[model samples]
Target chain A: MPTVELRFAALNGHVRTARMIATAVSRCAGVPAGAADEIKLAVTEACARAVRVNRRHAPQSPVHVALTETPDSFTITVADRGQSGDEVAPGPDGGLVTASTLLDLEPDSAAPPWWSEPAEEESEADGGFPPGLGLALIEGLVDEVQISRGADGVGTIVAMTWHTGPAVAPSDSIL
Target chain B: MDLSLTTRQEGNHTVVVVGGEIDVYTAPKLREQLIDLVSGGSYHLVVDMEGVEFLDSTGLGVLVGGLKRVRAHDGSLHLVCTQERILKIFRITGLTKVFPIHSSVEDALAAHE
Candidate 1:
Protein backbone atom coordinates (compact mmCIF):
# COMPACT_ATOMS: atom_id res chain seq x y z
CA MET A 1 0.00 0.00 0.00
CA PRO A 2 1.04 3.58 -0.61
CA THR A 3 0.12 6.49 1.65
CA VAL A 4 0.32 10.25 1.49
CA GLU A 5 -0.27 12.70 4.32
CA LEU A 6 -0.61 16.46 4.38
CA ARG A 7 -1.25 19.08 7.05
CA PHE A 8 -2.26 22.63 6.26
CA ALA A 9 -3.81 25.69 7.86
CA ALA A 10 -7.55 25.36 8.32
CA LEU A 11 -8.43 27.97 5.77
CA ASN A 12 -10.82 27.90 2.82
CA GLY A 13 -7.96 28.53 0.40
CA HIS A 14 -6.25 25.30 1.39
CA VAL A 15 -9.21 23.23 0.27
CA ARG A 16 -8.22 23.69 -3.36
CA THR A 17 -4.70 22.50 -2.67
CA ALA A 18 -6.10 19.49 -0.85
CA ARG A 19 -8.26 18.60 -3.83
CA MET A 20 -5.35 18.97 -6.20
CA ILE A 21 -3.25 16.62 -4.08
CA ALA A 22 -6.08 14.08 -3.94
CA THR A 23 -6.49 14.18 -7.71
CA ALA A 24 -2.78 13.67 -8.27
CA VAL A 25 -2.56 10.80 -5.82
CA SER A 26 -5.69 9.09 -7.12
CA ARG A 27 -4.49 9.33 -10.69
CA CYS A 28 -1.10 7.91 -9.76
CA ALA A 29 -2.77 5.07 -7.87
CA GLY A 30 -4.54 3.89 -11.01
CA VAL A 31 -7.96 5.20 -10.06
CA PRO A 32 -10.12 5.40 -13.17
CA ALA A 33 -10.56 8.82 -14.70
CA GLY A 34 -14.25 9.01 -13.90
CA ALA A 35 -13.71 7.90 -10.35
CA ALA A 36 -10.88 10.41 -10.03
CA ASP A 37 -13.40 13.23 -10.26
CA GLU A 38 -15.45 11.68 -7.48
CA ILE A 39 -12.39 11.37 -5.31
CA LYS A 40 -11.43 14.95 -5.92
CA LEU A 41 -14.85 16.30 -5.01
CA ALA A 42 -15.26 14.09 -1.98
CA VAL A 43 -11.86 15.02 -0.64
CA THR A 44 -12.55 18.68 -1.30
CA GLU A 45 -15.81 18.52 0.64
CA ALA A 46 -14.20 16.75 3.56
CA CYS A 47 -11.35 19.25 3.72
CA ALA A 48 -13.73 22.17 3.44
CA ARG A 49 -15.82 20.83 6.29
CA ALA A 50 -12.75 20.30 8.38
CA VAL A 51 -11.63 23.87 7.71
CA ARG A 52 -15.01 25.25 8.70
CA VAL A 53 -15.08 23.27 11.93
CA ASN A 54 -11.53 24.24 12.82
CA ARG A 55 -12.20 27.88 12.09
CA ARG A 56 -15.24 27.85 14.34
CA HIS A 57 -13.64 26.28 17.38
CA ALA A 58 -9.86 26.13 17.07
CA PRO A 59 -8.68 28.84 14.76
CA GLN A 60 -5.00 27.98 15.21
CA SER A 61 -5.31 24.30 14.38
CA PRO A 62 -4.50 22.74 11.04
CA VAL A 63 -6.44 20.23 8.99
CA HIS A 64 -4.89 16.83 8.28
CA VAL A 65 -5.58 14.84 5.13
CA ALA A 66 -4.35 11.32 4.53
CA LEU A 67 -4.70 9.26 1.38
CA THR A 68 -3.94 5.57 1.21
CA GLU A 69 -4.09 3.24 -1.72
CA THR A 70 -4.70 -0.43 -1.15
CA PRO A 71 -4.95 -3.12 -3.74
CA ASP A 72 -8.73 -3.05 -3.57
CA SER A 73 -9.53 0.62 -3.01
CA PHE A 74 -8.43 4.13 -2.24
CA THR A 75 -9.11 5.72 1.14
CA ILE A 76 -9.15 9.36 2.22
CA THR A 77 -9.32 10.69 5.73
CA VAL A 78 -9.74 14.36 6.63
CA ALA A 79 -9.33 15.39 10.23
CA ASP A 80 -9.81 18.62 12.16
CA ARG A 81 -8.75 19.59 15.66
CA GLY A 82 -11.90 21.54 16.48
CA GLN A 83 -14.87 20.90 18.68
CA SER A 84 -17.08 18.53 16.74
CA GLY A 85 -20.83 18.98 16.81
CA ASP A 86 -22.92 16.29 15.23
CA GLU A 87 -25.68 18.69 14.29
CA VAL A 88 -25.74 21.97 12.46
CA ALA A 89 -26.89 24.78 14.72
CA PRO A 90 -28.65 27.99 13.89
CA GLY A 91 -26.91 31.25 14.67
CA PRO A 92 -28.38 33.85 17.05
CA ASP A 93 -30.40 35.19 14.13
CA GLY A 94 -32.01 31.79 13.46
CA GLY A 95 -29.95 31.10 10.38
CA LEU A 96 -27.75 28.06 9.96
CA VAL A 97 -24.09 28.58 10.80
CA THR A 98 -22.75 25.61 8.92
CA ALA A 99 -20.55 25.48 5.84
CA SER A 100 -23.26 27.25 3.83
CA THR A 101 -23.20 30.23 6.10
CA LEU A 102 -19.65 31.04 5.03
CA LEU A 103 -21.30 33.45 2.63
CA ASP A 104 -22.06 36.97 3.81
CA LEU A 105 -25.05 37.27 6.11
CA GLU A 106 -28.09 38.44 4.25
CA PRO A 107 -31.66 39.11 5.26
CA ASP A 108 -33.73 35.97 5.50
CA SER A 109 -35.69 35.38 2.34
CA ALA A 110 -39.03 33.76 1.73
CA ALA A 111 -39.43 30.02 1.31
CA PRO A 112 -37.16 28.40 -1.22
CA PRO A 113 -38.42 27.54 -4.67
CA TRP A 114 -40.83 24.64 -5.06
CA TRP A 115 -38.13 22.31 -6.32
CA SER A 116 -35.91 23.22 -3.36
CA GLU A 117 -38.63 22.78 -0.75
CA PRO A 118 -38.00 19.07 -0.63
CA ALA A 119 -34.39 19.70 0.29
CA GLU A 120 -35.47 21.90 3.17
CA GLU A 121 -37.77 19.15 4.40
CA GLU A 122 -34.98 16.64 4.01
CA SER A 123 -32.66 18.94 5.92
CA GLU A 124 -35.16 19.22 8.75
CA ALA A 125 -35.47 15.47 8.89
CA ASP A 126 -31.69 14.98 8.71
CA GLY A 127 -30.58 17.94 10.84
CA GLY A 128 -29.56 20.65 8.33
CA PHE A 129 -28.30 21.19 4.80
CA PRO A 130 -24.62 21.92 5.43
CA PRO A 131 -23.57 18.59 6.89
CA GLY A 132 -26.50 16.84 5.25
CA LEU A 133 -25.59 17.81 1.70
CA GLY A 134 -21.83 17.55 2.19
CA LEU A 135 -21.97 14.06 3.66
CA ALA A 136 -24.67 12.98 1.26
CA LEU A 137 -22.53 14.05 -1.67
CA ILE A 138 -19.54 12.14 -0.30
CA GLU A 139 -21.66 9.05 0.22
CA GLY A 140 -23.11 9.38 -3.25
CA LEU A 141 -19.72 9.74 -4.92
CA VAL A 142 -17.77 7.15 -3.00
CA ASP A 143 -18.29 3.50 -2.18
CA GLU A 144 -18.22 3.95 1.56
CA VAL A 145 -18.11 6.73 4.16
CA GLN A 146 -17.27 6.69 7.85
CA ILE A 147 -17.36 9.68 10.16
CA SER A 148 -15.75 9.44 13.57
CA ARG A 149 -14.30 11.48 16.41
CA GLY A 150 -10.61 12.14 16.39
CA ALA A 151 -8.31 10.45 18.85
CA ASP A 152 -8.80 11.91 22.36
CA GLY A 153 -12.25 12.99 21.22
CA VAL A 154 -11.31 16.53 20.37
CA GLY A 155 -12.44 16.84 16.76
CA THR A 156 -13.83 15.02 13.70
CA ILE A 157 -12.48 12.64 11.09
CA VAL A 158 -14.30 12.00 7.82
CA ALA A 159 -13.02 8.89 6.12
CA MET A 160 -14.26 7.80 2.71
CA THR A 161 -13.36 4.85 0.52
CA TRP A 162 -13.64 4.27 -3.19
CA HIS A 163 -13.25 0.86 -4.73
CA THR A 164 -10.93 0.23 -7.64
CA GLY A 165 -13.69 -0.32 -10.16
CA PRO A 166 -16.48 1.38 -11.97
CA ALA A 167 -18.07 4.27 -10.15
CA VAL A 168 -21.48 3.63 -8.68
CA ALA A 169 -24.50 5.36 -10.17
CA PRO A 170 -25.44 8.35 -8.08
CA SER A 171 -28.56 7.67 -6.05
CA ASP A 172 -31.58 9.95 -6.25
CA SER A 173 -32.01 9.77 -2.48
CA ILE A 174 -29.18 12.24 -1.97
CA LEU A 175 -31.63 15.13 -1.98
CA MET B 1 -7.26 28.34 -9.63
CA ASP B 2 -8.18 31.72 -11.09
CA LEU B 3 -11.78 32.84 -11.63
CA SER B 4 -12.94 35.56 -13.95
CA LEU B 5 -16.54 36.76 -14.09
CA THR B 6 -18.00 38.92 -16.83
CA THR B 7 -21.59 39.99 -17.24
CA ARG B 8 -23.65 40.89 -20.30
CA GLN B 9 -27.28 41.84 -20.65
CA GLU B 10 -29.56 40.01 -23.03
CA GLY B 11 -32.97 41.62 -22.89
CA ASN B 12 -34.38 40.99 -19.42
CA HIS B 13 -31.67 38.60 -18.29
CA THR B 14 -28.13 39.15 -17.01
CA VAL B 15 -25.70 36.52 -18.21
CA VAL B 16 -22.56 35.98 -16.14
CA VAL B 17 -19.72 34.12 -17.78
CA VAL B 18 -17.49 32.48 -15.21
CA GLY B 19 -14.09 31.00 -15.98
CA GLY B 20 -11.91 28.90 -13.65
CA GLU B 21 -12.13 26.64 -10.68
CA ILE B 22 -14.66 27.43 -7.93
CA ASP B 23 -13.66 25.95 -4.61
CA VAL B 24 -13.77 27.08 -1.02
CA TYR B 25 -11.13 29.73 -1.70
CA THR B 26 -12.65 31.36 -4.76
CA ALA B 27 -16.35 30.83 -4.04
CA PRO B 28 -16.61 34.02 -2.00
CA LYS B 29 -15.72 36.10 -5.03
CA LEU B 30 -18.50 34.50 -7.02
CA ARG B 31 -20.87 34.92 -4.08
CA GLU B 32 -20.11 38.64 -3.82
CA GLN B 33 -20.70 39.06 -7.54
CA LEU B 34 -24.04 37.29 -7.40
CA ILE B 35 -25.15 39.26 -4.36
CA ASP B 36 -24.14 42.52 -5.98
CA LEU B 37 -26.10 41.66 -9.09
CA VAL B 38 -29.20 40.77 -7.12
CA SER B 39 -28.87 43.84 -4.93
CA GLY B 40 -28.52 45.95 -8.02
CA GLY B 41 -31.89 44.66 -9.21
CA SER B 42 -30.53 42.39 -11.92
CA TYR B 43 -32.64 39.58 -10.61
CA HIS B 44 -32.80 37.32 -13.63
CA LEU B 45 -29.41 35.59 -13.90
CA VAL B 46 -27.87 32.98 -16.14
CA VAL B 47 -24.45 31.76 -15.01
CA ASP B 48 -22.35 30.10 -17.66
CA MET B 49 -20.28 27.34 -16.09
CA GLU B 50 -18.81 25.96 -19.27
CA GLY B 51 -15.47 27.52 -18.38
CA VAL B 52 -15.49 26.27 -14.82
CA GLU B 53 -12.97 23.49 -14.24
CA PHE B 54 -13.88 22.56 -10.71
CA LEU B 55 -16.66 23.08 -8.16
CA ASP B 56 -17.00 21.95 -4.57
CA SER B 57 -19.62 22.18 -1.79
CA THR B 58 -18.73 25.78 -0.98
CA GLY B 59 -19.28 26.75 -4.58
CA LEU B 60 -22.54 24.84 -4.66
CA GLY B 61 -23.66 26.58 -1.49
CA VAL B 62 -22.98 29.96 -3.06
CA LEU B 63 -25.11 29.02 -6.05
CA VAL B 64 -27.91 27.86 -3.78
CA GLY B 65 -27.70 31.12 -1.86
CA GLY B 66 -27.83 33.08 -5.11
CA LEU B 67 -30.85 31.08 -6.19
CA LYS B 68 -32.67 31.83 -2.97
CA ARG B 69 -31.85 35.52 -3.24
CA VAL B 70 -33.20 35.79 -6.76
CA ARG B 71 -36.23 33.69 -5.95
CA ALA B 72 -37.05 36.06 -3.12
CA HIS B 73 -37.43 38.85 -5.66
CA ASP B 74 -39.59 36.76 -7.99
CA GLY B 75 -36.48 36.44 -10.14
CA SER B 76 -34.72 33.30 -11.38
CA LEU B 77 -31.23 31.86 -11.71
CA HIS B 78 -30.25 29.46 -14.44
CA LEU B 79 -26.99 27.54 -14.96
CA VAL B 80 -25.22 26.81 -18.23
CA CYS B 81 -23.01 23.75 -17.80
CA THR B 82 -21.83 21.06 -20.20
CA GLN B 83 -18.93 19.51 -18.33
CA GLU B 84 -19.89 16.14 -16.95
CA ARG B 85 -17.58 16.51 -13.96
CA ILE B 86 -19.12 19.83 -12.96
CA LEU B 87 -22.64 18.60 -13.75
CA LYS B 88 -22.08 15.55 -11.60
CA ILE B 89 -21.69 17.77 -8.54
CA PHE B 90 -25.11 19.34 -9.13
CA ARG B 91 -26.67 15.97 -9.80
CA ILE B 92 -25.18 14.38 -6.70
CA THR B 93 -26.34 17.27 -4.54
CA GLY B 94 -29.86 17.02 -6.08
CA LEU B 95 -29.56 20.61 -7.21
CA THR B 96 -30.30 19.47 -10.74
CA LYS B 97 -33.94 19.52 -9.76
CA VAL B 98 -33.62 22.85 -8.00
CA PHE B 99 -32.06 24.99 -10.73
CA PRO B 100 -32.75 24.91 -14.41
CA ILE B 101 -29.49 23.81 -16.09
CA HIS B 102 -28.79 24.10 -19.78
CA SER B 103 -26.01 22.89 -22.06
CA SER B 104 -25.58 26.12 -23.96
CA VAL B 105 -26.04 29.84 -23.40
CA GLU B 106 -28.61 29.93 -26.15
CA ASP B 107 -30.69 27.23 -24.49
CA ALA B 108 -30.47 28.94 -21.09
CA LEU B 109 -31.49 32.29 -22.55
CA ALA B 110 -34.32 30.71 -24.50
CA ALA B 111 -35.59 29.00 -21.38
CA HIS B 112 -35.38 32.22 -19.35
CA GLU B 113 -37.31 34.07 -22.08
Candidate 2:
Protein backbone atom coordinates (compact mmCIF):
# COMPACT_ATOMS: atom_id res chain seq x y z
CA MET A 1 0.00 0.00 0.00
CA PRO A 2 1.07 3.56 -0.68
CA THR A 3 1.72 5.95 2.19
CA VAL A 4 1.42 9.71 2.59
CA GLU A 5 4.30 11.23 4.51
CA LEU A 6 4.88 14.71 5.94
CA ARG A 7 8.00 16.18 7.54
CA PHE A 8 8.20 19.48 9.37
CA ALA A 9 10.15 21.25 12.08
CA ALA A 10 9.42 20.32 15.69
CA LEU A 11 7.34 23.39 16.48
CA ASN A 12 3.99 23.85 18.18
CA GLY A 13 2.59 25.82 15.25
CA HIS A 14 3.16 22.90 12.90
CA VAL A 15 0.69 20.62 14.67
CA ARG A 16 -2.25 22.32 12.99
CA THR A 17 -0.82 21.73 9.55
CA ALA A 18 -0.12 18.11 10.37
CA ARG A 19 -3.72 17.62 11.46
CA MET A 20 -5.02 19.28 8.30
CA ILE A 21 -2.96 16.98 6.14
CA ALA A 22 -4.05 13.94 8.13
CA THR A 23 -7.69 14.88 7.76
CA ALA A 24 -7.34 15.41 4.04
CA VAL A 25 -5.58 12.14 3.55
CA SER A 26 -8.06 10.25 5.68
CA ARG A 27 -10.93 11.72 3.71
CA CYS A 28 -9.27 10.85 0.42
CA ALA A 29 -8.86 7.33 1.68
CA GLY A 30 -12.61 7.12 2.21
CA VAL A 31 -12.65 7.26 5.98
CA PRO A 32 -16.15 7.90 7.37
CA ALA A 33 -17.11 11.23 8.84
CA GLY A 34 -17.09 10.14 12.49
CA ALA A 35 -13.94 8.08 12.08
CA ALA A 36 -12.35 10.96 10.22
CA ASP A 37 -12.95 13.16 13.24
CA GLU A 38 -11.28 10.56 15.43
CA ILE A 39 -8.34 10.41 13.04
CA LYS A 40 -8.05 14.19 13.09
CA LEU A 41 -7.97 14.42 16.86
CA ALA A 42 -5.75 11.38 17.30
CA VAL A 43 -3.25 12.60 14.71
CA THR A 44 -3.19 16.08 16.22
CA GLU A 45 -2.35 14.70 19.64
CA ALA A 46 0.29 12.40 18.21
CA CYS A 47 1.94 15.18 16.23
CA ALA A 48 1.75 17.65 19.10
CA ARG A 49 3.40 15.17 21.46
CA ALA A 50 6.12 14.50 18.92
CA VAL A 51 6.82 18.20 18.44
CA ARG A 52 6.94 18.79 22.19
CA VAL A 53 9.17 15.78 22.81
CA ASN A 54 11.54 16.85 20.03
CA ARG A 55 11.76 20.42 21.27
CA ARG A 56 12.73 19.22 24.73
CA HIS A 57 15.47 16.75 23.77
CA ALA A 58 16.49 17.31 20.13
CA PRO A 59 15.52 20.84 19.18
CA GLN A 60 17.06 20.56 15.72
CA SER A 61 15.28 17.37 14.70
CA PRO A 62 12.03 17.27 12.75
CA VAL A 63 8.73 15.50 13.32
CA HIS A 64 7.52 12.98 10.79
CA VAL A 65 3.95 11.78 10.13
CA ALA A 66 3.00 8.96 7.80
CA LEU A 67 -0.47 7.77 6.89
CA THR A 68 -1.34 4.48 5.29
CA GLU A 69 -4.69 2.99 4.39
CA THR A 70 -5.11 -0.74 4.68
CA PRO A 71 -8.06 -2.93 3.79
CA ASP A 72 -9.54 -2.77 7.27
CA SER A 73 -8.12 0.32 8.90
CA PHE A 74 -6.29 3.62 8.58
CA THR A 75 -2.93 3.74 10.28
CA ILE A 76 -1.07 6.85 11.40
CA THR A 77 2.53 6.88 12.55
CA VAL A 78 4.04 9.94 14.18
CA ALA A 79 7.76 9.82 14.87
CA ASP A 80 10.14 12.31 16.49
CA ARG A 81 13.91 12.37 16.90
CA GLY A 82 13.96 13.32 20.57
CA GLN A 83 15.19 11.21 23.48
CA SER A 84 12.55 9.08 25.25
CA GLY A 85 14.33 8.96 28.59
CA ASP A 86 11.65 10.55 30.76
CA GLU A 87 8.88 8.35 29.36
CA VAL A 88 10.71 5.21 30.42
CA ALA A 89 12.52 6.50 33.50
CA PRO A 90 11.71 5.27 37.02
CA GLY A 91 9.92 7.44 39.53
CA PRO A 92 11.41 8.69 42.82
CA ASP A 93 10.00 5.69 44.71
CA GLY A 94 11.66 3.30 42.23
CA GLY A 95 8.30 2.51 40.64
CA LEU A 96 7.67 2.82 36.91
CA VAL A 97 5.58 5.83 35.93
CA THR A 98 3.88 5.80 32.57
CA ALA A 99 1.94 8.48 30.74
CA SER A 100 -1.25 7.30 32.39
CA THR A 101 0.58 7.40 35.72
CA LEU A 102 1.38 11.08 35.24
CA LEU A 103 -2.27 11.69 34.54
CA ASP A 104 -3.10 10.02 37.81
CA LEU A 105 -1.81 13.01 39.77
CA GLU A 106 -4.51 14.53 41.90
CA PRO A 107 -6.04 17.81 40.87
CA ASP A 108 -5.44 20.78 43.17
CA SER A 109 -8.20 20.77 45.78
CA ALA A 110 -8.42 24.55 45.80
CA ALA A 111 -8.94 24.56 42.05
CA PRO A 112 -12.09 23.55 40.23
CA PRO A 113 -13.92 20.78 42.01
CA TRP A 114 -15.01 19.09 38.80
CA TRP A 115 -11.62 17.69 37.86
CA SER A 116 -12.03 13.94 38.18
CA GLU A 117 -9.51 11.87 40.06
CA PRO A 118 -7.49 9.34 38.09
CA ALA A 119 -8.14 5.61 38.39
CA GLU A 120 -5.63 4.10 40.79
CA GLU A 121 -4.43 1.11 38.78
CA GLU A 122 -4.53 2.76 35.35
CA SER A 123 -0.94 4.05 35.30
CA GLU A 124 0.68 0.99 36.81
CA ALA A 125 -0.62 -1.11 33.93
CA ASP A 126 0.92 1.18 31.30
CA GLY A 127 4.25 1.72 33.07
CA GLY A 128 6.03 5.07 33.47
CA PHE A 129 5.09 7.52 30.75
CA PRO A 130 4.93 11.16 29.72
CA PRO A 131 3.14 13.64 31.97
CA GLY A 132 0.26 15.03 29.93
CA LEU A 133 -3.27 14.44 28.63
CA GLY A 134 -2.13 13.94 25.05
CA LEU A 135 -1.44 10.22 25.21
CA ALA A 136 -4.63 9.44 27.04
CA LEU A 137 -6.69 11.40 24.53
CA ILE A 138 -5.04 9.55 21.67
CA GLU A 139 -5.81 6.21 23.31
CA GLY A 140 -9.46 7.14 23.66
CA LEU A 141 -9.83 8.30 20.05
CA VAL A 142 -8.14 5.40 18.29
CA ASP A 143 -8.74 1.67 18.17
CA GLU A 144 -5.18 0.53 18.71
CA VAL A 145 -1.99 2.20 19.93
CA GLN A 146 1.67 1.17 20.00
CA ILE A 147 4.44 3.24 21.52
CA SER A 148 8.01 2.39 20.65
CA ARG A 149 11.46 3.88 20.20
CA GLY A 150 12.52 5.06 16.81
CA ALA A 151 14.63 2.78 14.61
CA ASP A 152 17.70 4.95 15.28
CA GLY A 153 17.43 4.36 19.06
CA VAL A 154 16.39 7.98 19.66
CA GLY A 155 13.04 9.78 19.97
CA THR A 156 9.64 8.07 20.16
CA ILE A 157 7.19 6.56 17.68
CA VAL A 158 3.45 6.56 18.30
CA ALA A 159 1.50 4.28 15.98
CA MET A 160 -2.27 4.54 16.10
CA THR A 161 -4.73 2.52 14.04
CA TRP A 162 -8.45 3.08 13.55
CA HIS A 163 -10.44 0.23 12.16
CA THR A 164 -12.62 1.23 9.23
CA GLY A 165 -15.02 -1.65 9.59
CA PRO A 166 -15.19 -5.11 11.12
CA ALA A 167 -11.87 -6.68 12.06
CA VAL A 168 -11.90 -9.22 9.30
CA ALA A 169 -9.28 -8.84 6.58
CA PRO A 170 -10.59 -7.57 3.28
CA SER A 171 -10.94 -10.12 0.54
CA ASP A 172 -9.70 -7.63 -2.02
CA SER A 173 -7.03 -4.97 -1.77
CA ILE A 174 -8.10 -1.32 -1.84
CA LEU A 175 -4.68 0.05 -2.70
CA MET B 1 -6.57 28.91 10.98
CA ASP B 2 -6.63 31.99 13.17
CA LEU B 3 -8.78 32.45 16.28
CA SER B 4 -11.20 35.27 17.05
CA LEU B 5 -13.14 36.01 20.25
CA THR B 6 -16.14 38.26 20.79
CA THR B 7 -17.70 39.01 24.12
CA ARG B 8 -21.23 40.12 24.93
CA GLN B 9 -23.36 40.46 27.98
CA GLU B 10 -26.25 38.07 28.40
CA GLY B 11 -28.20 39.14 31.40
CA ASN B 12 -25.83 38.58 34.33
CA HIS B 13 -23.45 36.39 32.34
CA THR B 14 -20.57 37.23 30.04
CA VAL B 15 -20.78 35.20 26.86
CA VAL B 16 -17.59 34.76 24.87
CA VAL B 17 -18.12 33.56 21.30
CA VAL B 18 -15.03 31.84 19.95
CA GLY B 19 -14.31 31.31 16.27
CA GLY B 20 -11.76 29.47 14.15
CA GLU B 21 -9.36 26.78 15.32
CA ILE B 22 -8.19 26.36 18.91
CA ASP B 23 -4.78 24.73 18.95
CA VAL B 24 -1.35 25.50 20.33
CA TYR B 25 -0.95 28.57 18.11
CA THR B 26 -4.33 30.13 18.90
CA ALA B 27 -4.91 28.92 22.47
CA PRO B 28 -2.98 31.82 24.03
CA LYS B 29 -5.49 34.24 22.53
CA LEU B 30 -8.35 32.45 24.27
CA ARG B 31 -6.29 32.16 27.46
CA GLU B 32 -5.62 35.91 27.54
CA GLN B 33 -9.26 36.70 27.04
CA LEU B 34 -10.34 34.38 29.82
CA ILE B 35 -7.65 35.79 32.13
CA ASP B 36 -8.79 39.32 31.43
CA LEU B 37 -12.41 38.43 32.10
CA VAL B 38 -11.56 36.77 35.41
CA SER B 39 -9.16 39.49 36.59
CA GLY B 40 -11.59 42.20 35.55
CA GLY B 41 -14.16 40.80 37.97
CA SER B 42 -16.32 39.19 35.32
CA TYR B 43 -16.62 35.65 36.68
CA HIS B 44 -19.88 34.25 35.44
CA LEU B 45 -18.65 33.23 32.00
CA VAL B 46 -20.22 31.15 29.26
CA VAL B 47 -17.85 30.20 26.47
CA ASP B 48 -19.64 29.46 23.19
CA MET B 49 -17.40 27.16 21.21
CA GLU B 50 -19.90 26.22 18.51
CA GLY B 51 -17.81 28.10 15.98
CA VAL B 52 -14.61 26.29 16.90
CA GLU B 53 -13.44 24.16 13.98
CA PHE B 54 -10.69 22.41 15.88
CA LEU B 55 -9.57 21.87 19.47
CA ASP B 56 -6.45 20.24 20.86
CA SER B 57 -4.76 19.70 24.23
CA THR B 58 -3.59 23.30 24.33
CA GLY B 59 -7.18 24.46 23.99
CA LEU B 60 -8.27 22.01 26.68
CA GLY B 61 -5.56 23.33 29.01
CA VAL B 62 -6.79 26.88 28.55
CA LEU B 63 -10.35 25.90 29.39
CA VAL B 64 -9.20 24.08 32.51
CA GLY B 65 -7.14 27.10 33.50
CA GLY B 66 -10.12 29.39 32.94
CA LEU B 67 -12.30 27.18 35.10
CA LYS B 68 -9.77 27.36 37.92
CA ARG B 69 -9.51 31.12 37.57
CA VAL B 70 -13.25 31.64 37.80
CA ARG B 71 -13.67 29.13 40.60
CA ALA B 72 -11.08 30.97 42.67
CA HIS B 73 -13.42 33.94 43.01
CA ASP B 74 -16.39 31.77 43.87
CA GLY B 75 -17.57 32.36 40.33
CA SER B 76 -18.50 29.81 37.69
CA LEU B 77 -17.52 29.05 34.11
CA HIS B 78 -19.75 27.13 31.72
CA LEU B 79 -19.25 25.92 28.17
CA VAL B 80 -21.65 25.97 25.24
CA CYS B 81 -20.49 23.35 22.79
CA THR B 82 -22.74 21.23 20.53
CA GLN B 83 -20.30 20.06 17.92
CA GLU B 84 -19.52 16.39 18.33
CA ARG B 85 -15.99 16.99 17.12
CA ILE B 86 -15.41 19.64 19.76
CA LEU B 87 -17.26 17.66 22.39
CA LYS B 88 -15.17 14.62 21.64
CA ILE B 89 -12.04 16.44 22.72
CA PHE B 90 -13.56 17.25 26.07
CA ARG B 91 -14.76 13.70 26.52
CA ILE B 92 -11.42 12.23 25.57
CA THR B 93 -9.58 14.32 28.15
CA GLY B 94 -12.21 13.57 30.79
CA LEU B 95 -13.07 17.28 30.80
CA THR B 96 -16.69 16.47 30.21
CA LYS B 97 -16.79 15.57 33.87
CA VAL B 98 -15.17 18.85 34.87
CA PHE B 99 -17.11 21.30 32.69
CA PRO B 100 -20.77 22.12 32.77
CA ILE B 101 -21.28 21.78 29.02
CA HIS B 102 -24.50 22.87 27.42
CA SER B 103 -25.84 22.62 23.93
CA SER B 104 -26.39 26.37 23.58
CA VAL B 105 -25.73 29.67 25.30
CA GLU B 106 -29.39 30.08 26.25
CA ASP B 107 -29.40 26.65 27.87
CA ALA B 108 -26.21 27.37 29.73
CA LEU B 109 -27.54 30.68 31.01
CA ALA B 110 -30.84 29.11 31.94
CA ALA B 111 -28.98 26.49 33.93
CA HIS B 112 -26.89 29.19 35.58
CA GLU B 113 -30.05 30.81 36.81
Question: Candidate 1, after superposition: displacement of residue A146 in Å?
Answer: 1.1
Which pairs of residues collide in model 2? A82-A155, A97-A128, A97-A129, A98-A127, A98-A128, A98-A129, A99-A129
Model 2 over residues A83-120: C-alpha lDDT tens digits? 76434334456533332333443354354333332212
CA lDDT of every candidate? 0.75, 0.74
lDDT (Cα, tens digit) per residue for candidate 1, span B1-113: 68889999999999999999887788778988988998899999999999998887778877887887787788899999988888777765557767899999899989866
The list of candidate 1 runs beyond 4 A from truth reads A87-129, A165-175
Tens-digit lDDT string for candidate 2 (B15-35): 999999887778878988988
DockQ of 1: 0.38
Docking outcome class, model 1: acceptable
- After TM-score superposition, the amount by which residue B24's alpha carbon in candidate 1 deviates from its true location, in angstroms, is 1.1
TM-score computed on alpha carbons, candidate 2? 0.81
